[model samples]
Target: MASLFQRRRNKATQVERVRERRHEGFLRYAGFRWAKISASLCLLVIVSYALVDVTPRHNGGSWYGYTLGTIGAGLILWLTALGYRKRKMTSDHWSLKAWTSAHVYLGLSLIVIGTWHTGFQLGWNVHTLAWALMMLVILSGLYGVVVYATLPAALSNNRDEMTQMQMLEAIRAFDRQLHTAAQPLTPEDTAPVLAALDEDPFAGGIGARLSGRYPDCATAAAHRALSASRSSDAEAREKVVGLLSQKQAALGRLRQHLRIRALLEIWLYVHVPLTFALIAALSAHIVSVFFYW
Candidate 1:
């Protein structure tokens, strides 16, 4: 019995390792388990919407509409809970990964549930506002998903195993070399080298960071100015120019890193605020339905 138990435990451990390797992404979680469930749900809603007949045709005022509305509202509330779920870390049946998978797939099903609840009757009202907000939230979420899936690898590759501080250090080292190399040059040539040394790597604002374009880069300007020197101290000018070129290359890599990071995070600025607006609009919609309508 002891030997049998040991064998079973070893087999369980091997199986678990395989499972860990296979279940790497939330999109493919449980063999797309949530996706299959969500698809079935959408199909059911679509089929029921077509088959079930209501007096004066289906509309938000009908019993069927109210039922669909309740389901949709419930789903919205649950999906919103995902923000809270992220606060706690767990690896159980309802793990964060599992919750996120469900959030994405089930949240997508709202398009069917919400539209069917309206019975295709849309207008200029809080109901329509709520629907629009939900769609915006979903679209923003899709954008976040796409960036998260694709940009992380690019970010890692661009980093080249160096931390941000290390990149800055490299530029600083080039500046030190430029300072020493400029000592023998004339004042006119040294002025540009000094400007490059004093230039801030992070001088540009958010616009420049996101775009990765530094039109006013002092390093580049200095390199250009020094490169064109026809002065007597040709060797000293060349050394300064070379250091400036290396500094510019370092700055480019750093800016590229900033741009990728900005792309990854900017979506949250749109997504989180819209989620709050959606909840507010959704609340007003529910209250109006029960009390006023």
Candidate 2:
């Protein structure tokens, strides 16, 4: 309806707007289209379970139960495919963001499908074992999703735009300062200060890092000793104590960095292996059923 020049202007504006649009994260990718689809799928399974009638008491051997089982197995395979899909890079329709969104929602929907497949039956058998493992896998994945969504922002805030190495270097710099400040103090006082200066901030394993609890920390121990003792050289002792406090602050930041990093990473250690184990158990359940039946 517009003139030629106005049409050209509108086209240019549209291009510019598209260029300036914010990048969509995995959760909101495609306007959470996958989430709504997954929700509908779960609702469908639940409603079908309510409506379907099976003879000789409903159980995993029933027709509806088998249908749900097949769907759950296929969904599990697709959900696991995200691990492989993430390794490839592409900006086309099947982007990593799209894959991740599907993995999360569909993985969650498995809770309903897998449970309904059992028809609320439980026992000490391979079938129930598989169900328990599937629950574990989904629970671990949900933990990953929760931490991934919230912890990155907290990590960035804690880092204050600095890289990991930069934070470590800052701690080392404080250690050097502590060493220099302790030079004028007497041996009795300098002993604790030197211990603080030589303390390693990154000396702990995953347990120590995640727990954020280091009772045997040398720097902390030294600080307590220094604060409790009264030395002859008050000036030098005060300087040493101040440096120890500074070193403690640096170590605290370092430990916090480690804590957040561990929280972000620890889930994968549990999530990935449990997933394969779950699939294996599910397979065994299937094989045992057909073999024994």
Candidate 3:
């Protein structure tokens, strides 16, 4: 009886393992198919552009520009459809890794098609504005790509699966430990510890955060003060200094975490506004082209 039960349990586990494998295979196939279809369509548009001759129209317009723009717009529409389809399908289909790969490669292709559509012309008009906005969107997207590709790995290695708040909490715990360790020090030696605790962590403005030059970082100031303080017991003073060094190290880690987060967020500011502007400019450009012709 015991042997029969064990065999049944193993069989059930094997079935579950097979199911999981099948699910993963399905996901891989879906992702590959999506990428393949989008890529093939893009290639087809490129080939059509090459085969179909578009002569330049007079009066500040060209058949080439209109043709390229129409094809580019179609690709953009298809890409947008894929995004919507992925969202509707399931979360796994829109994984960050897959979305990022699509975003970067497809976005680069947009730059090529959009520039060609402009025919390298720039002026004080809606067309120029549309072109500029598209460039800004592409540049901001590139920034996001770089940050996502590099910083997430760095953040993972630095944090080891811990959340940002958890990392900050750990740093604070270390600070508390240091505070306890410094408890035995004399008043003269304890001044820096007090100063560090009193310091404002969020006093810097946006510029200071971006530039990484905190003018009012009390931790550094306290360390300097501690180093210069004349103490009667050299041994105790050295111990306090050691604790201050550890505090500085902890503070540095906290600042690094903040910097990485800031880098991740900064590009969105450029991207979102440029996207809105692109929409408005594109609308005007389209209307002008059709209405005037």
Q: What TM-score fits each model?
A: 0.90, 0.91, 0.72
Candidate-wise lDDT, in order: 0.90, 0.85, 0.68
- TM-score of model 3 vs. true structure: 0.72
Candidate 3 per-residue lDDT over residues 194-290, each given as its tens digit: 7777665555777766666776777677678767877536666666677667767766666666777788999988887777678788888889999
TM-score of 1: 0.90
Per-residue accuracy of model 2 over 47-111 as CA lDDT, tens digit each:
87777778876788888888898999888888888878989999777888888888888888989
Q: Order of all candidates by TM-score, from best down to worst?
A: 2, 1, 3
**What's the lDDT for candidate 1?**
0.90
Between candidates 1 and 3, the one scoring higher on TM-score is 1
Flag clash pairs in model 1.
none
Decide which is better by lDDT, 2 or 3.
Answer: 2
Between the candidate structures 1 and 2, which one is better when assessed by lDDT? 1
Which is superior by lDDT, 1 or 3? 1
Show where candidate 1 strays beyond 4 Å: 1-23
- When sorted by lDDT, best at the front, the candidate numbers are 1, 2, 3
